[model samples]
Target chain A: MPKTLTKKRMIINIIISLVVLLIVINICTVTGTRSISLSNVLKGPGLEPGDNIDYEIFSVRISRVLLGVFVGAALACSGAVLQAILKNPLADPYILGISSGAGLGAVIAMLLPGISLSFLGGLPIAAFAFTGAIITVSLVWSIGYFTGRSQVTSLLLAGVVINAFFSAVIMLMTLIVKTEQLRSTMYWLMGNIPEKQESFLLLSCGTFVILGIIILWRISNNLNIITLGEYESKGLGIDTEKTKIVAFSFAAFITAIAVSLSGLIGFVGLIVPHAIRLIFGPDHRQLIPLSAIYGGIFLVISDTIARTAFGQEQLPVGVITAVIGGPFFLILLARYTRKVSLMK
Target chain B: MNIIEVENLGFDYGQKTILQKVCININKGTFLGIIGPNGAGKTTLLNLLCGLLKPKTGSIQIDSKSIESYHVKELARKIAVVRQEFVPVFDFSVTEIVSMARTPYLGSFAFPTESDRQIIVESLELTDTAQFADRLLGSLSGGERQRVFIARALAQNTPILLLDEPTSFLDMKHQVGIYDLLKNAQFRQYKTIIAVTHDINLAAQYCDEILLLFPDQNYKFGSPKEVLVQEQISKVFGVEVMKGEISEKIFFIPKGNYIKNNK
Candidate 1:
């Protein structure tokens, strides 16, 4: 049996998670090819460009770490909400076809360079990817909602089918694109942590993600009731359908932002929520906030590994996540399934 | 006085009529048992009364207010339902699950207050689930889990409680234990209980009133003795039933072919 989480224990856990996140941020910032010290980072970027190489590298690393933190939090929170509302443990943000749709949108943008000019100086690919994610989720939501008795099951099935179709389209587009474009597309598909992003874009996305998480936090209890299945949720006065709409919209919106920032990062969403649930318990009020914090920590660590492990060549952060997270998730899955079977 | 009044309630799925013109008036604190064979729409009736499903025709009134007029939270405060099965994705402890019942009473940012915590504790004690309060819900036995779910319903602190096949999966001992718990809740807490079950004898033993439903939206509503007649049970259920009394309470035993042939 899982130990019940007391208020004091939960508070301590939260504090520890925050501390770990800070330590990880510092460690990740000081890592990489240049190997800048914490003191150098503390001095901050100098006024003159290129003159203070240490500070410049430090600042760049900090930005990347910040991006990793935001991206991870968004994905994990989205995953937690999706799993609760969908009533499926295996559910992740990308399971809603967000990734495939984003991939397809990005592939189209690459194949046709004319669309890129609509944005001034910023990566229009991110914009296209965000649009694609929103469109795909909306399509899945309506199709699943209007079609039937078991809504979540229908929603999942629709997502899977739509995801397949989009992936196929992306594949076809890749076949015809020029070699240079293909290489970029392949890089994007594998997913890399960009060294720099427009500060405005980063700020906006971070703000939105934080806002979404806060909204989800406010309704955390509702998410808990909704997980008990439809009949029970309604009995608890949840307005289950309304809760689903609100949760689904927020989760998808934030996930779109994360996917737009970093191309199709996997496993953070799928694993972090489960790990948090196992360690701290499954009450959503705690689950949502803890998962977000720990998610940031987990991704920062994984991204750091991605940067340092390959020695300047740099493995895509997504690959590092799957390679590390896949096995860890499987172990949790095994323990989870065994416990369930024992209960029977 | 009637706490729940149903008039000409009709429900159907697409073209198939599941319930038609069902009507009943249940007074406060009444232990009403709903019994039927498969596909008799007993569960559907329970859903409709609780506002989970809307009636296709006619109306339902709770405390003389139209059912549809009550907000979901408002309705929840008036009625609590214990489902047949609860399988949660994340395994929450018994106390945690029961505390969720306080959601309707909580403000947007408020945690469970002192009063709410008192209610949760009281519910666990009442349901004899206090021992399992800290145990994860999945780790408990089926009977234990069912009791925890009942504890949750009790924590809702509603005037009325509805259950759908509350003991269909339990063994005889567990089945008796559950019915006993419901009867106690009805007696001690003065809660109005409406349970849908397939256990006819148990219904006769525990319920003050019985509703017997047949296919095609037909039903009989009356005292248990009036509704659970041997002839009616045999006719509707398509089986042979012999009625008897034990300790002055009515009971029924189905007379299968083996019994008839041997006798």
Candidate 2:
């Protein structure tokens, strides 16, 4: 059973999470043939942009750590919002087909590198991916109209069908793309941190995350109302349709940004939110911010394990998270499921 | 003065018509109970009253203004509802649940003001749930949960309150306790209250007026004395209920199909 979330406990948990974040940042920076030493791990977290130090390796490591924080937070918060909007605790980018849809968009951007659209600016892939995810989420909800029941089973079915259909489209895209582009798309779809760590990418992603936090916070009260079902929310004078549209758009948009940058990383969205809910209870006011913080911590830990788990050859971070989160999901399913229906 | 006016109201679920041409005029401070058999659209009517559902055929006016003209938050400020079923997305505490009733009142990033806090406290006190305010809603008993919901509705602090079978999940003891609490709030607080109930005796004792929804978009609406006649009750329910009066309250006693069985 989950313990009650008190004010003091929430504060303590947040402080502990910050400490863990610093430790993970330390771990991410320490990379060499030699096993990580405490002192070595502490070395390159220093030196800001344009500062004097071993800027080459240290800067890349720092950038990767920042990327991990950004990607993880975006995905987890997206998951939390989706769960709230759908009124299903299990909804996430991966399960609702956002990742695959975004993956297809990113693949298209890569395949047609010469045919870049000017509107999306520097990150056309990210923009396309965002559009793809938003379209997919809306499609999934629209599909719910045909299913009659909007509760657990029908929503899951809608998500599952969209996920399956999108994956097939992505597979077809991969088959048709140029051989060189196919390899990169496969690596991305499998989930790996890309080599491009431009400061602007970091800045834009950071800005997005900050913006997401503000929007989510502003709507946090509405989220609580939404959880009690559409009638209750509508009866309370909450614009249920408006709240759902805004919240779900953010959820999918956030997931699309992460997918564009880090490939289609699964399980971070699902695993992190559920973990936070157990400790912090289900209030979106706490769940939104805490999930972002804990999401960063969870992904940094997983990414570190991915980089280090295989000697000489690094594993895609997505594989490592899946290996951990698949069983975690099964355990959750076995523990709580009266009916065995879910999206992968 | 009529706080709410429904004119020629009608609705349908899929192909089947639930209520049609139903008219009701409720004055301020009246306790109204809606009673009907299964599938008679008791909840459907409640939804239309609260603006959760738009009427298919007619119009509803609140304080002489059309229901369609009111904004969501504006309507919420004027009226509040406690529905029959709820599926909480998270296992939030009772305090959290009750505090959510302030959603329409509070602006973004606004905490409840001191006045809001006082009302919440009074609401919990009214429902006798102040002692369990900090407890998680999922951990509470059915009766306790129902009271907490009523407390939440009270915190809405609207001129009109609506509930759909508020005591459906409760035991007989708690059922009566809830109606008693509603009765006290009606006289003391002067809030216009509407509820759908299966318990005729409780409704007869508490509600000033009752609305009965029958099949095929038909309805019976009037004061308890006008609507709860023996023939009307038998016609709507399809059951023979022997009635007896105790002082001011009308009580119902069910008489099984002994004549049919004997025949």
Candidate 3:
């Protein structure tokens, strides 16, 4: 488990995983409430997809799948970077309270009347969520710096405290909403994949997320050195604070994007990186990219189950993930504790 | 020739002064050891010398250039350090861990080049850790792990090396073994080493000069024989000690109350 793969092996594995992800995406795109022919879907959708019901459904499904792909990849990569910077294996995007902050912002935006920004695909909710996430992270970082002896411990504690506070406020707001709005808000809170989105918006977010992942990839070597400890990394010529800020910001940014797109998809971040690290080794160079692909595969599969699992009633994608992730997390915790005991 | 110069250097944590008015000049290729009781700022001084901590006062010059003038990466290329042993957050392989020494030399998009790989291999061989290249660092024995760290420092290819108690948590054989490796590194590679250790005997044996720090922000610097006097040792350590010499190297045996009562 502690061994690393050779570069050749890593490349081969990535290529194989990419192929698997593509296959999963295709299967998921085809299987929905109304099953569509794989052959018809594979054929290029004409410019006027609206005229044909199948083509319209196919495009929507494909976009939803792609959204899942981007969100999943973003979360997993963010989790990997957080774990490295925080020096904690269990750290994920949600651990920093970004998800709660984004949720609170989304809830507040939904309650208010129309306030849209055309530049951000006319989604003021997303803008607010991103703002909320950033503000929460800044607050957490500041509080952590002043209160704790070590940055790692302080930030984590601050995140926990802030997360609790924000979640309570969000719940209170949810209770006050009318029954008609309550369903959508609750669904959003639980996390649902949107059936359709403006293509321009998706493209912009996809590009942003991909760029964030690439940036994290560029700093993979620095992440490797930083994991050795702050002073040790500094001695190795790293500006430890600068690296942490960069890593945390990018990780949080992408997580914020994912949270804004799809409410609060839980375990993709927490599970994918750990599984990849255990399998492929802890080298960030390989871990980051592999986690991105596998994370996509995992979420696409989960969303598909959420849509088609029961008859007619569509469950939120988050429900499927948590249903699966809860057990997976327990197993991971057990294995982690065993590993710690063995190390001791 | 002096490769490092510290003049009127001072450090403080909030209101409490840790070190003050310390001036010392270190020659190129000299093995200098810093020794003191706990809370005497040994590690702090080491941190300051490496530019990990900014000095509150005075200046440190490395190779006649101000230490602050060098960027972090530049300073790393000039000086390597091996801190006391601890488990790495991730269990990277021994070779993988050692190869990390090339961090300063790597560009943003670059992997290890041929020369970098060569240096890493040579460092592993020098520290006798080549056999464990593929093994996880966490699986190694304490002595082996220590050697792997030394190999990493060697791979850094810096002119100066600073270690903080490199032999702590080790038995006698491992202690001597690490010192022997460091001594050979000094003689063969002309590495300027400054190690902080409580083991004064090892310091006396391996270090060309010693810097003994006192809790009151005072310090004495000279050859071990000149600096490690009986009165100063007793006053600084708060213990009586019996000194012995063998092969011209001095060693101390603390005459604790338990020993006195037994006698």
Model 1 clash pairs are none
lDDT of 1 by residue, A195-288 (tens): 7887787888889999999999888888888898888888888888788889999999999998887888989998999988876678888899
Provide the lDDT at A13 for model 1: 78
Candidate 1 stretches with Cα past 4 Å from truth are: A1-11, A37-47, A114-122, A330-344, B261-263
User: Which CAPRI category fits model 1?
Assistant: medium
Error of 2 at A190 (Å): 2.4
How high is the TM-score of chain A in each model?
Answer: 0.92, 0.79, 0.89
Provide i-RMS per model in Å. Answer: 3.7, 6.8, 4.0
Q: Lowest summed-lDDT stretch of 10 residues in model 3 chain B?
A: B108-117
Q: Which portions of model 3 miss their true places by more than 4 Å?
A: A1-10, A42-51, A113-122, A146-149, A326-344, B261-263
Q: Which ten-residue region of model 2 chain A has the weakest summed lDDT?
A: A335-344
Say which prediction, candidate 2 or candidate 3, comes out ahead on TM-score: 3
Q: Fraction of true inter-chain Cα contacts (below 8 Å) kept per model?
A: 0.61, 0.63, 0.56
Distance (Å) between predicted and true CA of A39, model 1? 4.3
After superposing candidate 2 on the true structure, give the runs of residues whose Cα lies further than 4 Å from its correct spot.
Answer: A1-23, A30-53, A106-131, A145-155, A169-185, A323-344, B13-15, B85-87, B259-263
- Please write out the lDDT profile of model 1 over residues B1-263, one tens digit for every residue: 99999999999988889998888999999999999989999988999999988989999999999999999999999999998766577787788888888888987533677788889899998888898687778788888899999999999999999998999889999999999999999999999999999998899899999999997578999998789888989999999988898886888888887774645
* TM of chain B vs. native, candidate 1: 0.97
TM-score, predicted candidate 3 vs. hidden true structure: 0.93
lDDT score for residue B257 of model 2: 65
